[model samples]
Target: MAKYLDSNKVYRALAFIDPYGMTVNWESIQALKGLGIDFWILVPTGLGVSRLLKNDGNISEAWQRKLEKFLGLDRQYIIDYFYQRRSVSTLFGEETQINKEKDIVTKIGNLYTERLKTVFEYVSESFVMKNSTNSIMYHFMMATNNHSGLKIANDVIKPKYKL
Candidate 1:
């Protein structure tokens, strides 16, 4: 679809609504950036981080394998790299500190922040959408630079609840 859009010169910008932002190819994204194509990514931030951390039934193993196949890296290597990059060591002193052990929210927020930093150059904007209630949705926008693209995304793909 990106190739088609590039060949036909059809799209002005591309918005990727990725659940985890793990499957994305940064090289391809960089190439698209070279072509002057704008991007907005709606990355899952809060609950998704908790889910990944909990990994109750080896579900994360499946995701790990999938990511390994996509990124062509060892699962353990990926885990180590992501953890090292996203570690809140300064905030909590050492890895085994009591404060770090208890504050899952801060840990997850730092993880998401680190992930965002990795792609800071490629994307014009990113958003984190949290489930406000069982039915309602709330969005927190980040890295917002492309005003027009953000406007388009808010208008077209904003979630609707069946209330």
Candidate 2:
């Protein structure tokens, strides 16, 4: 699609990326930078990103690769963003422990939104999606260069509970 879009310079598009897991690479999305496109992406916040973020901050190589690819960020950066290090006094000596931050899903959503802003001029607030257990599972967001499109998307993406 990137190649096709590159060849068709005059084509404007509305692109939606629906990934079941951390399958979408940040580089793929970065290819759409400055294009005449309004993009909507389904970020698997709880199911993918949060699941990869271990409580101890000891992310495995595979998980680190997945996160680095999906987020286009360094593993250390992601770790620092999601976890904090605290010193604990043990019997032997002082030890540092890694603690995962609270409300991580919201932080992940905000991170992805900031990433979108790097490519597009305007980004709409996320439309939060939750599971049957009311756990936040995904965040749907829109990125566009057009301000009018962003305004319309912001209005449309609002969660409707009563209806």
Candidate 3:
């Protein structure tokens, strides 16, 4: 789809909204950003973060294979994804160990927030939407090139998804 947009010369500042932000390739995202394509990514917070960290006893071999493929890495990267230090080290230059579930949730949120800041010129926390079944509110990040696009996204799109 990015290739199609590029071929047709469509550069009117588009947005890609997705729940699986972790699965997205940052390199491809950078290429699309060069073409004025912004990204609104949903960060799985609360229980979702715990599930991902623990693998939830539901991750099958097939699911692991799919995750590996999505992340474009081998098994070691998958291990690192689950076991790596989850902290605000990049921003604060100090690593705080995450030992509890609440700490893990906070760390995941901080990590993604930092990632959005690192990748985009303008980043905003659009809103949080609650999951009906689990009753967990997941945070969303809106990454854009300029303030106008961020305004449009926050004023228009953000309200629609507000819980």
C-alpha lDDT values of all predictions: 0.43, 0.91, 0.57
lDDT value for candidate 1? Answer: 0.43
TM-score of 2: 0.92
Q: Compared with the true structure, what per-residue lDDT tens digits does model 1 show for residues 1-163?
A: 5565454545444444453444554454444532324454443334433345432223367766654543445766545534433324666574531111234444444444454445443222223344556421223333323456546645554446643
> What's the lDDT of the predicted structure labeled candidate 2?
0.91
Which window of ten consecutive residues has the lowest lDDT sum in model 2?
1-10
Stretches of candidate 2 above 4 Å error?
A: 1-10
Candidate 2 C-alpha lDDT tens digits along 1-163: 5555544656778989899798999998888888878899999999999999999898899999999999999988998899999999999999999999999999999999999899999999999988888999999999988899999999999866642
Ordered list by TM-score, greatest first: 2, 3, 1
Look at candidate 3 and tell me the lDDT of residue 137.
51
Q: Cα miss at 52, model 1 (Å)? A: 3.1
lDDT of 3: 0.57
Cα TM-score per model: 0.40, 0.92, 0.53
